[model samples]
Target: MEKKIKPCIDNEQILKQRFLALRDTLDLLSGKWRFCILLNLHYHQKLRFKDFFEVSEGISPKVLTSELATLEAHQLIQKKVEYTPTKDITYYVLTTHAQEIWTVLNTLIEFGLSNRQEVIRSFHSDKN
Candidate 1:
């Protein structure tokens, strides 16, 4: 006996909504350094502009400033300024909303690890 599966009545509309949602998410997260910056914040909790530049190797001060502004504008990260006798220091910290991205980041890390292993294996096989 063959079993029949029923599809949702609003399948097309649901698919469209999901597609748009994914597109929006990608647009928000798109860029070479966004994820890297987010990951550093996730692990470090907070970082200053100079700290990011030092840790993110290869990222220029201008690009880091731009990316930090974008993240702050999106509400994914918050910028804090401390006034001191010596100078004002600024730091960036991830928002609670940004915690949701850990799940996505973990999934990406897993996929990347698996893909890297596969690529290495393929390269070795090709060498044979």
Candidate 2:
């Protein structure tokens, strides 16, 4: 038998909680370098520390280290040590979960492109 689907609604408390959580998550992922780091890994498969620094120019070593640690902690990316010996370094690659996030971020990019001026104005206004 086919089951009937009920439309679900969120009450005020749940809505507020969810909104706050979303804001927090976005804040973490939308830092100056986090989004670019994620996109680079997603598109390029993997990158070394210098590769990341080169691709997303102007990111300091300190910021890159912090962002990479945060992304790894969030389970959005993975670090693999390759050729262990001497220089034996690691590369960053996106986890499956990060791919899912990339899809949503692409949608947001499209939306932002369509509203670039409005977004700029809003951002500038918020600073005052």
Candidate 3:
């Protein structure tokens, strides 16, 4: 049996609120390196400034600095400095405030994979 899909409706205020929320999310993660940095920190737990360059090729020091600053400002990540005996190291880690983003990130991952399949299919169809 085929299932029926319900049509959803929202009031003006609700639409505005939803738009603002999405805008805020995009503002926080909008950048070439923001999502990549988030992904790395999620998997690695913590990472030093220099470590980003290793995982993300073709990224410059300036861009990384800018992206890190934005993430820090938005409270998506925290920066910690460690000083041992001879050297000081700075690490970037996720903050509790931004923990909610993990759910959004997972949704994005699924959307990305599904979109990739569609793109590949379209490309193959175009070639035929």
Candidate 4:
């Protein structure tokens, strides 16, 4: 007789943990500046490090670097080096995954703008 395969309970627990981790990552990237970065990238094709610094006004260099690194690590964006005779320069471009994320971000932006007054009032009321 052939041996029967049992469903792994531990695998389900691991999958749940993975889901929570993914959710936490999304929440972390949903911050103000991070969202701005994504929106800017969606409109712009690719940007050099300096261009990003210039376009994303008021963002500290350290924070921008950190956010870019996080996005790169998540495979949402790609870093490429453009070779030159003098020096190699790196630039950031959105990946396919990043484009998909832009769709979700757009929907979120539309919803937020539509409900801004309500959200603001709720925040103030909750502070009491």
Winner on lDDT (3 vs 4): 3
- Model 3 clashing residue pairs (backbone): none
Question: For candidate 2, what is the TM-score?
Answer: 0.75
* Candidate maximizing lDDT: 1
Q: Which candidate is the best by TM-score?
A: 1
Runs in model 3 with CA error above 4 Å? 1-10, 125-128
lDDT digits (tens) for residues 1-128 of candidate 4: 99976656558788788889889877768766877877777888888888877788888888889999888888888999999999998888889887878777889888888799788989999998
Between candidates 2 and 4, which one is better according to TM-score? 2
Ranking by lDDT: 1, 3, 2, 4
Query: Candidate 4, TM-score vs. the true structure?
Result: 0.69
Q: Write the per-residue lDDT of candidate 1 for residues 14-109, one digit (tens) a residue.
A: 877888999999998999999999999999999998899777999998999999999999999999999999999889999999999999999999
- Model 4, residue 49: distance off in Å is 1.0
lDDT of 3 by residue, 42-117 (tens): 9898999888888888899999999999999989899998999999988999999877788988999999999999
List model 2 lDDT by residue over 1-79, tens digit each: 9996543644667777888999988887887789889888877899998998778989999999999999999999999
Query: What does each candidate score in C-alpha RMSD?
Result: 4.6, 8.5, 6.3, 7.8
Q: How far is candidate 1 from the true structure (C-alpha RMSD, Å)?
A: 4.6
Q: Comparing candidate 1 with candidate 2, which one achieves the higher TM-score?
A: 1
lDDT of each: 0.93, 0.87, 0.88, 0.83
